[model samples]
Structures are given as C-alpha cells and as structure tokens.
Target: MDSVTVEGRAAAELLARKTSLAQTATDALYADMPELTTRYGAVGRERCLEDIRYTIDHLIPAIDLTQPSMFTAYVGWLDDLLRARNVSTREVIRSLELIEQAVRNELAPDEANVVASFLRAGLDSLGAVRREG
Candidate 1:
C-alpha cells in the first residue's frame, strides 16, 4: 500500500491504528445508520466494514483528503455507487459523523483529531456533490 499521508507522524503508526479503531466505527454505524443496515441486510456488517476501511485506507491519507484533484474523484465515485445502491447521501454523512464520534470517544486527543479529520473530509466531499447537483 502507498504510505499514509496523515500529517505529524510516521505513516506506520497512523495506519496501524486504523484497525484498532475500525470496530468502534463499525459499532457506531450499526447504531447510527440503521436504515443503511436494513438496506444492505445480510451484508450490513461487511458493507459497513468496507466503508470503515475505505475511510482509513483511501480517505485518511493527506493526498486523498487534502488534494481536490484526488478527493473529488473519490467523491464522484462514491456518489455514483451510493445512488446505484439506493443509499441516501445523508445516511453516509450520518455514518461519518458517528465514526468521528467514536474516534473522539476512543482515541487519545491528538489521535482523535487525526482520525476524525478523515471522516470530516469525507462528509464534506459528499456534501459538495449535493451542492454541485
């Protein structure tokens, strides 16, 4: 995998923490995005897990989160996929919110800032699509 670009630390330290926090985000999604859970049904956990991983592996990096060139591409692709899946854009936003909440509750203060930054950026990217449309 390409190195994570979250500012202020070794890529290894930041990237390695992703999995530790994944389950908390996952749990929050189950509680907070019930409609999404229902929409995906039997695959809800898998789908939610996938989202958490995508946020960490793709969205968390400074390259993906900070640069509009790459970030906009992710925004477009995710919007298309959600539309095809019949998932509301708001549901995704709520899930990102919950992920941030979970990170704040579970991580050290600085680490929480780092982790929540990715979720916030994702929520912002998704909202941008709505404004453009």
Candidate 2:
C-alpha cells in the first residue's frame, strides 16, 4: 500500500477505537450518574460528540512534529478543563491512558503525541464546569 493509504488506514482505525472508547465511557458515566442524562439529555451527547470531532479534526493538526513542548499547552488546557469540571482525576487518567494506548499503537512517531493531546483536550472540553478553575 502507498504511504498515504497506510496513514489513512491508521487514522481511521484510531478514530474507530476512540469512538468506541467514548461510547463505553459515556455509557458508564450515565450508569453511574443517571441524573446527568436526565438533566442534560440530548444536548450533552451532542456537545460531547462535537468535542470529540473538534479534537480529531483540529487540535490533532496543530501539533509541532519537532517540538514536544507544544503538546504541553494542550495538556494544560485539558488539565484546566478537568479541574473545572471536578471530574475525578482517576477517570480522566483512565480515559487518557486508553487514548494514549490507541495512539501509540496506530499513529506515526511524530503524530502520536498529537492524538494523545487531542484526546485529553476533547475529554476536558466536553463536560467541563462552566466556572473558571
């Protein structure tokens, strides 16, 4: 296969895996906090999906291949959002670990951190608190 085809396949696989993970996480979150579903309903799901798409489409492309420090900005953004949400740090860590595993397995060397950072940003942005941290 051509290089582009290979990369495309890898990207597609990563997206699929991440989508599955998001679905599973959402299900678990709802199971644990049924009130969240009642309170936010469809809007919450829509926002969550939008966040995922934004990360996959936009933030992933912003990574600097030669400089890992660029990823720190994304990480810090995620940290701030998570802190705002009061999302259990353990849950955030678990989700991040899953995304990192997928990216490490599927992405090219220069792109792995980008995907990881995007996942962090997406999760944080989706359900973060309205108030500042």
Among these predictions, the greatest lDDT belongs to 1
Best by TM-score: 1
**TM-score on alpha carbons, each prediction:** 0.72, 0.42
Q: What lDDT, from 0 to 1, does candidate 2 have?
A: 0.50
Model 2: per-residue Cα lDDT over 1-133, one tens digit each: 1224433444555555656645554555556566656766888756544444443443332432323334445545655675577544444445455556546765676556545655555455434533343
Q: What is the C-alpha lDDT of each candidate?
A: 0.63, 0.50
Model 2 segments more than 4 A misplaced = 1-40, 62-66, 85-91, 98-133
Candidate 2 differs from the real structure by a C-alpha RMSD in angstroms, to one decimal, of 7.0
lDDT of 1 by residue, 61-95 (tens): 55333543454466567768877877777766766
**What stretches of model 1 exceed 4 Å from their correct place?**
1-6, 10-13, 63-72
lDDT for model 1 comes to 0.63
